[model samples]
Target: MKIFKERHFFRLVIVLLLVSMASCNKKKNSYTAVSELDKKTFASTQLIPDDHFLGDASCKTCHAKEHDYWQGSHHDKAMQVATDSTVLGNFNGIEYKSQGVKSRFYKEGSAYFVNTEGPDGKYHDYKIEYTFGVTPLQQYIVKFPNGRFQCLRTAWDTKKHKWFDLYPDFKVVHSEWLHWSRGGLNWNNMCADCHSTNVRKNYDEATHGYDTKYALINVNCEACHGPGKDHVEAARSLGKDYKGNGDLKMTSQTKPKALVDACARCHMRREQISEYYNFEGSMLDHYFPQLIVENVYYPDGQILDEDYVYGSFVQSKMYHNDVTCTNCHDPHSLKLKFEGNKLCAQCHVPETYDTPKHHFHPTGTESSKCINCHMAGRYYMGNDFRRDHSFRIPRPDQSLKYDTPNACVQCHKDKDNQWAWEAYVKLYGKPKHKHFSDLLAPGLRGEAGGLNHLLELAKDTIYPEIARASAVNVMTNYADPQVIDNLLHFLKDESPLVRGASLDVLGEINAADYVNYLLPLLEDEKRSVRVKAFFALGSLDEALIPEPYKAVYKKVKKEFETNLKVTSDFVGGKVKQGNYYLKQGKLLDAIASYEAALEIDNTNNIARTNLANLYYRNGDFANAEQAFKTIITQEPEYGQTYYSYGLLLAELNRVEDAIVQMELAIKYMPDNIRPYYNLSLLYDKANQLNKAESTALKGFKKSPQDESMLYILAYIYSKNNEVEKAKNIAKRLVDLYPNNSNYRAFYNQLNAVQ
Candidate 1:
């Protein structure tokens, strides 16, 4: 998976380099033209007809069995107005205390209420508006003015039958957006889209309000199929004589891709293009799924955060074999097609896979369950346990080597990875096939041969698009010529994921010379692709864009702006807007965007950190310092904040204070080599030879292949009268960069020294 490294670290390093040396135009002619800009043919744009959503009720007459099966299912009961029957929580004036806050859930005259601290940190009697989810846990939703509905942090565990806090350990302040009264926990913006059918978040960015609308209160028949108006019309015209296919455009068993797209619309963590989603065309045209990035997924593509199922399922061999969501899951009831191991037996021979000999465990135990080894479960939302849909084998060997979590070790807490590894080989023997994680884990961490392996993986068509995209993104850390070439090549990849991820890397590199290459993507079929291209072109000079591409850029730019505004109700959207404005050199607009994000979510560290950097960019040092100080006070362990603050302090000539911050950054981020390089330089400037030499040597030890670090270490060693060490380091640099005369001359001089 692509690791989201701290951008400030790169900014610091780049600032130290001469601008001309890092100029994109230096080798512009070296790249060959792949092809002329060809306008892509997109899927036909179709809007839902008026009164299109007939809801699940309309399907009852003909599809009685399907309709009956859907009733009282998880999807059917996803959202419900709080009532005597629907509510599962205790509402008898029971007070629950968590994180020093006392909340009382009670009932009065058929009304359900919760007395809890609201946005202002004062107790308020908030009426329970709705019940969200019907599973291991169920949360209550409270409505506020301006069309906002927030899900309570405390939910009733249906299994345990007790109220529990989702974030039991964190003391969330009332002013924080995560405190349930704010945007982070807002049901209308975040949860409503997935929970209901045909939901529209009519957000007004100007007013910061949502006039949300929905066709159905819960997931229904039309949610899986397209809007039913056209189908209904065709069926009525036939009048009980419809013997043919009825020529309905709605997704069905015939269209596997469309069906998966329909399921992924809600099942994936994605950014939606419009208020409405359809079961036609590419899902990428309307929504951009979250890539296998850090925090969201482990480097080995295991579930880390609440990714739902789409991302993991797409990586599985079953998906490549054209296994749609409906293959395993019953579409209407949202349950497995068969009980227990029977699901696997449908695909694999029962004699080979469903026996004790294959499973290596006694029959009828949890360990013998197919899901226990292949589809490992992770506990989420305090009580819910969601299994990984990737269906990968347990690799305890990888767990030991790469420090990645393994299903075997996860279940066998009393046993170590070595024991699990030995047991695995003893039972099933060594792995016969290479997994994507083997390359991905090392590539993402910048370990030995990472750059080449990632580049190869990105270009390999056989791997999943998500893994390939991740490989392209991991190339960003290397900043090599081959990385740039590979990234540009991926822009033309068939999958939208690869193309979009390539654009992300392009934006970071500021590839001004690739303006022509990026311009054509503005008119790409997918909205996600177009949006990524627009952002990638943020660094390109507007005037330099050819006249033919100007109109297209303007249209896509507006689309991108509208996309940002659609999610402006959340802090993340504001941060994206801030980044866009900042890239476009709209200082005031960027400042306003960041400030607005902070206003919505007071404890948003990312927004605060970026705001501080912007203040420093605008030469407002006092505010920058204050912002950094606030972050330090709020999150002392955050290494990126300290690293950025150290850079800011150094820029302002507070060398002594900067050194302290740099030390803290290193203390928090030991693996990062930037702090060591800068700290060594700082110590040298302060005339502390021993500290400078030691720090330089430490950086060199950490990154032996890093040319800059090697040069610094060589210089430091020479200064400290360590001629042999200097010669050895300089010789390695010369060997690495044989064409560079400076390195060769430096090596010769060091070698000649006594």
Candidate 2:
């Protein structure tokens, strides 16, 4: 039996279920009633004099129906004060143990307290300031000095009614930034913007603190419908002297795309651009949605991590077909409009879809469900089974070939992928080779036939923009002329995502080559496109850029810089700022930024590694060596760190030490080709022909089409008198790149020699 195994792609699954919890209430059309169980655990909306934020209470007086429906919703109880009524967990001096650490949850008088291992790696009695989220799981937020609220590692499983560790697989030490007590889990920076309305993350970069303020404690009507001040004023002037139509700045956006973008501000896996923004413009203006890439998503665009919904939904046919989050789900109550097959029948014809012929399962069985086949669920946070929003069809054939999860075998725990694939073929006939997954899988793996397939997928307007952009992103690693040409064309694509992704790819390439090409993008309509254009231009030599374009660059560059500043309190933002500075050739500023990131979260390995690389690049060998050593000692499993350290050692003329580090890098990341190529070259330079040949051949086994590895292997084989092997490699290389003069010349030379 081929049971599905979770990969190590997501180091930590921080599943923040932005949407409402699952509902069993069989409401047909009317809004799901909010009972006593549904009362929003957090504070409700109230009118404030100066502030634009009118709490749920303010709206309830007029829009009582919406208020009642939204009362006990996920947004309503996103976070609340840890009180007798609010605290869901058993805090009656109960002890929960995991990984040699014991935490006691107890209540003193009316206050909830937890005696747990803190940031200092010692047990401390920390007051539960707030209860963050309630559903399959509920986490407690503990306030620290420096105005930080961190979600505790241990969470209460609401469904199971038991305590469970968020990171059950590993014992995260207190000192690590990923530890519950650190800034990585800080509520103000990570969770507050989405959970609350009119949130201003007043993060002080100089003070290294947050004076974070929010209008409403929970996501109220104004959160989605935009600020209610103008709407409320318009309502108040209803019978007074109101004009033709009250110019209410409400986001009553009926357009499917616009409405989704409004919701995406919270639901998307994205980066913040502005401190506070209403639903007035594009989501790309205020936040940059992360492209569907590895670590964040499966190669087939499945939700590999806790990528809420928007990222996956944007790639689905549903989003492209004008279907949105509100189509199936109630906009206010955030529950399904119908139950089971009836929900699918809302749009799809019941006779055509919700039957055994369509579902290919026994009627009324769990496998017969529409969601089971189309929207497979994956368990995150121990018990939270979130469904994949991509809504892809069951493709067990793809699963068998690519080792990705398929809905067919997800429920059939005792069946192998081959069994599922054969059954699917028998029932549905051979699946069409039309899915974006077919192209994306090869593109992500860097396998043969990827270039043409990916290029076609990218240019095809029929496919989802997110999927097309993802294709462009994966094609970035390839140096094909068509790849660059297609990317250049995509720079002018109508979709902001495509343009932004193309710019990201071109920026990594020779930025000077596309300097004039990306100049017009500085004034691009989308903020994401404009910022990416600025980034691409910023990569070039300042003097090489035209005078007229420099002004455009400066204006957009300020926006980019301000975006970084707005999020500088977090480790990720600081690291990004450091990278930006590094690209700008400000080594000291880059170093300072990285150092600042470490100050905020001491266990930020990316910052540490980047700092080490900078030190090495700047010729500070001593510090670089120390930094690399610390990283290796602390995070030995991180292959990239070892690979970087190997390069540093090589530069220092410590070839033997470099070789060892490179070998370790290969051990951890076998699929990585850089270490193999570099290690082989090092071996050849050291006159170790046997080791060089072995290393190159191993790399060839993993990535047979890798031109660099093939060249090195051919060279080593020819020098070692393995003429036949050298000629075979030469022939393959020439066949792969027929037009390449170098490959042809090398092949001819090898043939002549033979």
Q: Estimate each model's TM-score.
A: 0.89, 0.87
What are the per-model numbers of colliding residue pairs? 0, 4
Q: Any runs in candidate 1 off by more than 4 Å, and if so which?
A: 1-50, 243-251, 278-280, 541-544, 547-551, 697-710, 713-736, 741-754
lDDT of 2 at 115: 97
In model 2, where is the ten-residue run with the lowest total lDDT? Answer: 10-19
Best model per TM-score: 1
lDDT by candidate, in order shown: 0.77, 0.76
Q: What is the C-alpha lDDT profile of model 1 across 1-754, one tens digit per residue?
A: 0111121100000000001111121221111212223223333223343276787777787789989889989889889999999999999999999998889999999999999989899999999989988888899999888888889888999999999988788787887666778766777776877788766677777776779877788777776664665455556667677543432333354566566665676777776554345443467766777777667788888988777788898888888888888888887887889988888888899888878989878888888889989999788778888899998998998888777778888888999999999999999899989888877888887777888888777778888888888888777767578878777788899988999999977876565778878988987877778887988888677787889888878767766775676667666677777777767779988989999878776777888998998898899999999999999998899988888998998998888888899899989998789888888877877778899888888878887788878988888888889899898889889888999999999888887776
Off by over 4 Å in 2: 1-50, 240-253, 540-554, 666-677, 680-754
lDDT of 1: 0.77
Distance (Å) between predicted and true CA of 618, model 2? 0.9
Worst 10 residues of 1 by lDDT: 9-18
Can you write out model 2's per-residue Cα lDDT over 1-754, one digit (the tens) per residue?
0001112111110111111111223112121223332233111111222265577878898779978898888888887878877789999889999988899999889989999998899999999988877897898988888787778879998988999987688777788666777655777776787777776666778876777777777777777665555556666656355442422322345688877877777776776664446443356766777777777787788888777788888888888888988889987788999988888888889898878888877888887778888898788777788899898987887787778898876788899899998998888899765888888888887777888888988889888888888898889656677888888899889888899888877776557777779888987866667777877776677677678777656667766776677767666667767777767779999889988877876666767888998888788999999888888888889999889999999999999999999999999999899999999988987889999999999998988888888898999999899999999998898888889999889888888983
